[model samples]
Target: MNLFTKYLHSVTLSLSKGIQKIACLLLLSIPLFTQAEDGYKLWLRYDKITDKAQQSYYAPRLKTVYADLSDPSVKVAADELQLAVKSLLGFTPVVKAAGTGSQGLTLTIDPKTEGINEEGFSVSTTPKGIHIKARSGAGVLYGVFNLLKNIQTGADPNVTSSPEIQRRLLNHWDNHNGTIERGYAGMSLWKWYELPERIDPRYIDYARANASIGINGTVLNNVNASARFLTHEYLGKVKALADAFRPYGIRVYLSVNFAAPRILGKLKDADPLNPEVQKWWADKTKEIYDLIPDFGGYLVKANSEGEPGPMDYGRTHADGANMLAAAVKPYNGIIMWRAFVYAPDPKGDRFKAAYEEFKPFDGKFADNVILQVKNGPIDFMPREPVSPLFSAMEKTPVSLEFQVTQEYLGWATHWVYLAPMFEEVLKTDTHVKGSGSTLSGILKGDTFGYKMTAMAGVANTGSDRNWTGHPMTQANWYTLGRLAWDTRLTSESIADEWIRQTLTRNNAAVETIRKSMMKTREIYVNYTSPFGLHHVMGEGHHFGPEPWLDKAARPDWTAVYYHRVDSTGIGFNRTATGSNALAQYPGGLVEVYQDEATCPEPFLLWFHHVRWDRPMKSGLSFWNDFVKHFYEGARQVQDLQAEWQSVKAQVPPEIFNNVEARLQTQYKEAVWWRDACVLYFQTHSKMPVPAPYKAPERTLEEVKKLVDIYHIR
Candidate 1:
């Protein structure tokens, strides 16, 4: 018999009969060779390297590992490296404690490191092995993950990196009742019914995934929060999750109800200025910090969308936020007050609501309060201008909030990569200081010299076997974490890295997939809301085409309210003549956008209404150009399908099948969007469909009927 089989047989023979059965069952549970590709491992999947040259190169370097295990975070890092080495190099490394080794990796926590921040890490290589030095245990953990990523991508290991933002977080809009608002992946990850007593193994896996990508914080509940989360019963459950995640360096945060004083304490009225109300919040915050010592703090979505806030008591948002900030200050916690507020204005621009509301009270907030603003002015539309608040708020620290969930990008069914969108917004010159002052620079605190900086993504993860329903959507989650850690990373580079680690390492297949992924966001934009058309989806579901939607409970929620399509032309006049939202931008951008000819074509419809017969840069009229983009977008989906087929042999069968099926749905929906929008807008423009492309097979009326069916409960 082979040596492994002989050893196993002898070991089993030594065990008692019951112990032998248990050992056999344990052995059977773990595959002796390889695990199935079910996508649960995410980007950390350390599959055995099939490339002989790479194996030969990495095997020697991972012969031994030495790391200080005094810190729990560093212990997890050592364990992770050991696991990865065994899976990738085919043998477990000799793990030594608190000492240097002759070969393999060495992780050290050096508080006196010259350039590394608390959460940053530096990796250097020598003939003996690689060394990862960091200022904190969290940094060592981050360094370990980065080193593994470099090995997986076949990149150089000698690199020094730090997170540009102070806090990188994921805001989970998961309700207490196990429902996730706009979560398309599946049910909520937190099993509220069985927490504190029974800790699900999935919680550890979730923490591992987040830590691998450098996400340090997570908000546990929806921004439309329930006060029960602050109750003693729920605090115990939250404390249990915090304990499980602490080893991975992830701090748990909570989304709090602003009126918890009145709702839970049975106070007569909840007012920020009231001493009784302030004391209630102080007591609640103390109770929370006591349970979870490292609690990240609270995310407040108040005075917006009918939620209770100090505004209800005729007090300002600052009055409310500062009170909470003071309550958490003793525990070193910060308050993330959301600036996603908008009043029901039939004539006003929804894009200007947030800026106007918060800009006036810029310097009034407490030191620990961070005004969280969405990437765009309006809700997370497929395409939107960077919010004016990024430039307007000069005194208070502001954090960029991006929606990693595909709420407005066809939910989870459509294949849309959002890294490009995030990159575009980050790189756009806000002109806050001068010509080179980009949003990324502002967010990094380089341009503004702000006290704190952060980036929060509305999380898309759920309880699906694959965290995100669409297997490819996991890239969005990875992109957010990487960008949050370092805003300077290009979307192209992130896509390439993710494709190599998660999908395929084959160079040709990686390139094919990368190219396809890079084009998906723009392709989705073209078919759905090209040329800066925002909020055109169906009312509640936000799925199919709804460019024709003229009625809703609120005017701002309707598609026509923003588009402003008329017999003369189509587009919102945000310049001086209309909402004057352009004036809110810096003088340079205002001048650029005020004129129809100078404005970028992508935002042409967003800023000014132009004649349908106006000549476009492509030498085609506006209407003809619009029709071309619609057709081209639909055509691109077909091209993506063909490209995906080319890489079938490289991707796993389950992943390939999942993506292939999603592509079919995306293609069908793209066609529906193209046909429905072109036909519906034609009614206003009084123009026929441009030549070279035939009309849709289905009529506008027929398309409307289909959309109605989608809106059904």
Candidate 2:
């Protein structure tokens, strides 16, 4: 009986061991079968290199990492390199303290690196090994990410980067109730109910992504702010997030309500001149610094869009901003006072409001205060001339505030690459000091010679797994960060880099994607608001086309108010004969904009109202040219769809299918815009659809019904 029992135990154990070995073998092969890529990792996917030559070259060079282990940021940089090397090269790199050996990649702090600023980095391939040096630990982390990005794109591991703007930030319009103002991605990323107790791991990932892109700060709440964010309860929550982001070099900021003293502190008044109000802000600033020592200061949206400001107390914007600036000055914090104001005067051009208001008090702002101006005079339209305030404010330090979110460019549904739009505005000549006085130069303190410089993007990020709603839209966010870091980068180069890292490394696919991205913004402008017609979107929601919209609470908020269409002609006359808003610009720009014959066609209708039968530079009559732009714009979308489809085999199936679906939706919407605008404008122009372009099957009334559905809000 003992011999049989022993034999049975030996047989069972042998079979169990064999099964375990087979299971482990199968588990090892899982990566080969998993080809579906859901784009949760936005541009930081460190998948193994497909090119054998690149793998061979990078694998040996990154075999070890040498960095100082004393700093937390340096440790993070080393760990990130180890993890990236393991995933991309399929081998973990040995990370050791600096001076261990020079054979491997070395991370060093070099204060004398030329062109490398405080948070700037320089990387080079040396005879000893790869060398990465920066002035700070944050710079070291950025260098590591840049090195990995170079490896992924098969580029030379040599780069020197310094941010053009001092405080590059993402301004989140996320609310405490988990809703975003103009966000189309999803709900807010910050989980207020569980924060300060149960921090989500996503917070760390977010900070890591921002650091990699050279974004140093984030405003955690909507600018249409709530006073509750200043309370102790929310400050504790914000402090927890600050701690999570601090390791990755991201400072946290809050959008404070101007009436917080009255609302949160229960003060009788919120006047900037009041001593009690001044003391309250100082105390609040001290409280914030105590909780989060490295806290970035407030972003204010006072006296605009129903928000209360010092104007309510018979004071100026400078009076308000300087008060807050003085409060945080001891703590070395700054105030980003928004210059997005527009008055309710129906006769005055809204385009001239901000310039007139801010230009008067340019040098009155405190040293710690920066005037954050939008890229365009109007809102973030598809196309508009650069703000006149940029040139007029010589003594003020104005920062460029760009909207990375696609609010007017068909929010999340259409594929409009905004880098090109940003490039257009940045390259626009202010002509104040001379022809070379570009918006980029102004923001960099080269033109105005102001102290501080900053660039802020209204972020499009949300709780979507892809970060941005459309996977391709992630490029917009990436582009903003890249441009903020180095304004000299071309839109075309940014597109190429983004496509290689985020979508495909295949050369053919990258070229095809790059071309499409370059033209997407113009296509959007042509279809939606061709010839400088701005803010012609559906009232309230701003979703579908509503060129016929005339009724609204404010005249400036309506489409007809902007387009100013009548039986005789179309376009707003901002020239000498009309509102004379073109005079707001410098004399050189004013001359170009005042004349119909000399003005650029893109901005022709913005400044002058011409006859429908008047001849255009395009050789077509005004009405015919307008119709052609609308038709050609929609037609270009079809071409873009075909171009995208040509690279189907080159892209990952998940991304290919996702983008294809959006492209289809984009084409449909493009046609909708063309048909709606053409039909509505025809009521005034009384022109036919012209040769080759067929008339829309649906009437203007039919399209109005569709607009009604979209304007439920």
Candidate 3:
């Protein structure tokens, strides 16, 4: 075996022995779990260069990488390489002088120095043995992450990669108080006050994680932002974060409260057209740039959900976006204007809301402005059809914003792997530019051929010592990064990589988890929200079932609005009889959705109301199939729990215990979901429960009471 392999085996053996000794006395009653460090370490699990076999890896080649270190980004990349190499490869890589005389595994940045494309990287091992080149320091850092990934995945470290897109960012729905808006992973990791001064050591590891995954930017707060982040006091703190992230090639952006010019500054009104307001914003932007020269620009949630906007000031959405775009123009920054607006009226189609608000000003946005559209029109629900906005505005640059945090997909408690969901959306044909015009193709600027492009994910990271709360949930983050870099990659490939890196390189173990993960999203959909029955969660906190809830201020916020379950049957009538939102898509897709027969079965409930006795493609009556789905879903969870059991011997006891504990919860929740959903829907179907599926243990009132107790937390 290679030295790295031998070193890892030795360390693992000693570690396992230590654990065995600790648990020896208690062995009869309990199995000790694996070390907590296994999870906190994430996928960057590197080992020492023990045996002489892998000398070529460490030796003189990685001994010293010569970098001029002229640029801050360059210096950051070099320092990160040194740290990762030491911790993982068991050798501290030294940095020598840049350019002219550097030798062996040399990382070269600076266009004038190497002339590589701004987003491209090259790593070649020749007779002389090592040369790593990138267009910029950011590119070099990406290269380092790629190299670390190879070591972790057991791939040849000698390779080259060039990012297809210019920017890959993570959007945090984190508020000033540390509560992630829809976060299930504890509170936000960013302790705003302690920043710049206190510098939580977690910041470095956070940087390391993002750098390894090629995520180059972060918007620190929620789109529904608080004005406090704009003040001079907070800017200092933000600057400290910027400094910390510099080396990792991750730029920091602030989600601006649209009223900042008036609230933070003394402007009379934050009007996009007002001269003083414009000047106020420009000055603030300049100040932000001064502190963080690479400040990535503003992400705005204006005129949406009560957030102040250009509309409040008697201007259009484009006027609002373009105003900020103008402010950051001098600094080469861009604006991410959100297209998630709606007036919250039940009468209007919420599906058509974003398109209506954004379409009129499609070509009006400044070149630097990008409309950040969610994967679907509504909040991230399971199995949503691709957003209609993809084809609505052909002119503006659009960045696909997805949620990796599982806001609607059972949060951190349920084991729902989401790579399949991502792959499904990425491969969706928008038909914007014609046949095969995938969302990925469109966002890359090739479909409409625009310049700036990006893909963002609402971050799942928090203060959890495990990074993501559940051990397996880390796969979601891993999938997002890989897909952002290359939209065409399958969820299986990404999960496989994460499996090998985070858990084990043992092919059997990897294959088992990979199979489980690949089927996770589908299994979740089958049990919880089959056929697109969404927003059924108990109101606030979105925990458990509450399809009976309909008295909320807005219909969109109520469960009944989305599912439309009533005595006659279930599902919303989004066809021509209902919202007719299908008209928003291009001709071909509109036709498919308009006709009940052609509409995909997965979305059958989303578009049409059907009778309980209706026949389905699955060769069962609708009620039989529906009842079976609930039972099948619960069984899948139970089966998964069983599957997780068989592999206990293959994993560290700590990790095994952590996941096993979650699977227990998952099993209970799955039953809760199945029982409650089938019981309630059976009342609407006016049909008896399937022969195999027994009636729920309790009444609807009891289920509602349970929901109340569940969400009250």
lDDT of each: 0.90, 0.89, 0.81
Q: Candidate 2 lDDT (Cα, whole model)?
A: 0.89
Residue 166, model 3: lDDT of 67
TM-score of 2: 0.95
User: For model 2, how does the per-residue alpha-carbon lDDT over 58-129 read when each residue is reduced to its tens digit?
Assistant: 776788888897877888899889888898889999987786365779899777777888999999886547
lDDT of 3 by residue, 1-713 (tens): 55654454455556567775655434434423435554887877665444464555546667777776876666777777787678766778778777534346677775753434575677766544467678787777777667667665666777666666667889998888888888887899999868778889888888888877878899999998999999999999999999998878889999999998889887889999999989999999999999999999999999987899999968999888988999999999999999989988877768789988888887999999999999987778888888988877788889999998877887888888888998999898877766788888888878888799999999888878888898889988888888887787788889988887788767788888889888788888888888777778777677776677888868788887788777777877877788888778887777667777777888888788876777889889888998888889888988888878877877767788889998888878888888888878777777888787778888877876786576454
lDDT of 1 by residue, 320-422 (tens): 9999999999999999999999999998999999998999999999999999999999999988999999998889989999999999998888999999999
Model 1 TM-score, 2 decimals: 0.95
Locate the minimum summed-lDDT window of 10 residues in model 1.
27-36
**Each prediction's TM-score versus the true structure:** 0.95, 0.95, 0.91
Indicate the residue-level lDDT of 59 in model 2.
70
What CA root-mean-square deviation does each model show from the true structure? 4.6, 4.4, 5.9
